[model samples]
Target: MGRGRGGEREREERKRREEEEREEEEEERREKEERREKEERREREKRERERRGGETGGEEEKRKREREKRRRDRRRGGEEEEREREEERRRDRRRDRRKREEEERQEERRKREREYKRRGERGEREEEREK
Candidate 1:
């Protein structure tokens, strides 16, 4: 009976150690799973941040392009306005020159008419003195 009791006690002790070892292994497995989950979450968050930054960079580039286009258009408009003003000034100069020429021509015509009238009057006086 003493030997049987010793054997039974040893069996119970072995069973308890086995159960404790299994519990420890299970706890380690749970810890590993938690670590893996945390790592996966961190990777997902990093990816999201990178994607958001890329989108912001794209938007900034688009805004810069729009501003450059607006500046180019404004420059072109200013050049066109300057050209129009220059053309108008040239037209005004031409009109002034034409008017001056017209006045000179009228003055010459009046002088010629007055000289012809004086010659006619002198010829009439000579004819009356001879008669």
Candidate 2:
């Protein structure tokens, strides 16, 4: 009877220890699942933030392109103005050249008229001397 009681006590102690070990394993599993859940949540939030940032960056890039387009348009307008000014300068130079040629022609004509008058006076004086 004493031996039988001792054996029963030993069995009870072993069972309690097994139960405690199982409880500890269950707690560890719960903790691991909680940690995994938290990590997943953090990753999800990070992805959302990254997506939001990417969207914002795309919008900013679009805005920059628009600004660049406007700048290019303005530069094109300035180039057109410069071309027009160059055309106007060319026209002015042509007009000045024409005016200069007309002035020179008129001066030459005056000199020829003066020379003809002087030659006529010399001829009349020589005819009188010969007579």
Candidate 3:
């Protein structure tokens, strides 16, 4: 009974705030729906493009490009493998040369030992005859 005009003003202000809130909610819902629709449309378009590509032998073209790249890579790999084989051959040659040199050195040492043994036997024989 006492609050007449003040109550009316308060009611009007509350109603305005609620209406603004409802509008914001509606805008957010619309934005979400629009984003979903856009995403669906993009997916549909991508599928259609893929189907068209299949029909036009675009997949074959892609495969051809891939094959060409693999062929190039294999060619390069073959060159690298040849280089590696050449290096291995060089290493083997060096190893064989070292082995031959070592054998020659050992033979020289055996010859020297034989000569020294012969000289020692000759000296012993001479000493025994003197005794």
Write down the TM-score of every candidate.
0.48, 0.48, 0.45
What does candidate 1's lDDT look like per residue over 42-78, in tens digits? 6885786577667756777678757966986897698
Pairs in steric clash, model 1: none
Model 3, span 32-123: residue lDDT tens: 78669768966985786587576766668678757866885887688568757755765675576568658757976897899899999999
Per-residue lDDT of candidate 2, residues 8-122 (tens digit):
8659856865765686576568657866976896698578667766775677766875796698689769866975775576567557656855775797688688889999999
Find the 10 residues in a row with the least total lDDT in model 1. 89-98
Candidate 1 Cα outliers beyond 4 Å, as residue runs: 1-61
Clash count, predicted structure 3: 0
Model 3 poorest 10 in a row by lDDT: 19-28
Better of 2 and 3 by TM-score: 2
Report residue 114 deviation for candidate 1 (angstroms): 1.2
The TM-score, computed over Cα atoms with residue i paired to residue i, of candidate 1 is: 0.48
Winner on lDDT between 1 and 3 is 3
